[model samples]
Target: MKNVIITGTSRGIGLELVKCFAEAGHQVLALSRNSQPVSDLNLKQVTALSFNLAEATDFETVKAYVNTHWKQVDLLIHNAGALVNKPFSELTPADFQNVYTTNVFGVAELTRVLLPNMVKGSHMVTISSMGGIQGSMKFPGLAAYSSSKGAVITLSELLAEEYKDSGIAFNVLALGAVQTEMLEEAFPGYEAPTTAAGMASYIFNFSLTGSTFYNGKVLQVSSSTP
Candidate 1:
């Protein structure tokens, strides 16, 4: 079984991903601000931990735990993100910073801390949004969220190239609207074609086998445009 690490596992896509990996017999380290939902699962394969990605130092706890418990990580999914849906006119600098802190900076810090623990042939997946993909449809209120996710896509590309010799594959999945609390909050009354469980299954399968054939690619996964 693989040693998998996932962030933002309190609910929505992250929570479903934890279930998918844990049920498949992989040892999963699931992190979130509130890990009670994951802990409630009580699955031996899953270790739920509380973490606040906005605080870079919070990753120290994860680093210590991984150093003590796991020799290597087979997969790491950066699934945590923040959405500040507001018109550009109403958005503040702090709003942009907060979104970037959680979506980009936090991922970079966590990945940096965990890099030593990742074995050769390990896979890294960063969950982005279609809103971030260049030339894709754009919405006015998603400026902060979209820009931060866009940054993540570029960061993943750079990391993939830098780590190519290390045999660690990195990829970005620019997801379309998935039925989740975050999506609901971002676009009120809008219907999403994909469910959290469905997206989680796709992500889990990709994490297991994607590194074999794909690296440094940004894939758009969606059935219907939001």
Candidate 2:
């Protein structure tokens, strides 16, 4: 079984992703701001830690865990995201900073620290949004959230190119409206075609084999828009 690291595992898709990996018998490191939900599951071969993307020291916790327990990381899924649903005129500099810190900066910091534990055939999958896609449908209240998602897409593509020879693959999934708490926060009462568990299953499968077929690519995994 592979050693996998998944962030944002307290609820919604992240939580389901943890169940999927654990059921498949892979060693999992589940990270989130609130660790109780995952900890309650008490699944074997799963370690849940309270991790905050905005906190600088949390990245070190992951690095230390890998060094102490699992010497190598087979997959890293950057699934934690922050959202701010406010009009563009009301958006402040701090708003953008907070969103970027969780979505973009955190992804980079965690990946940088974990690179040493990752070897050939390792995969890094980042969960983005369809709103991040250029030329796609745009919404008004997501200026900070959408823009931050867009930034990480480019970041993944750049990393994939830089590490082409290292056998590490980076890819982004621009997901559409999924029935998640975050989606409810963005667009209340709107129903999504996909469920968290459904999307999680897809991601679990992709994390295991997507590196062989694609890298530096952004797949638009959506049937509806915001």
In terms of lDDT, which candidate is strongest? 2
**Best-performing candidate as measured by TM-score:** 2
* Candidate 1: tens digits of C-alpha lDDT, residues 1-226: 9999999999999999999998889999999999999999998889998999877677998998888889788899999989988889999999988899899999999989999998789999999999999999998899999999999999999999999999999999999989999998899988898899999999999999999999999999978776
Off by over 4 Å in 2: none
- Model 1 — which ten-residue stretch has the worst lDDT? 53-62
Local accuracy of candidate 2 as per-residue lDDT tens digits, 1-226:
9999999999999999999999999999999999999999999999999999988888888999999999999999999999999999999999999999999999999999999888999999999999999999999899999988999999999999999999999999999999999999999999999999999999999999999999999999998877
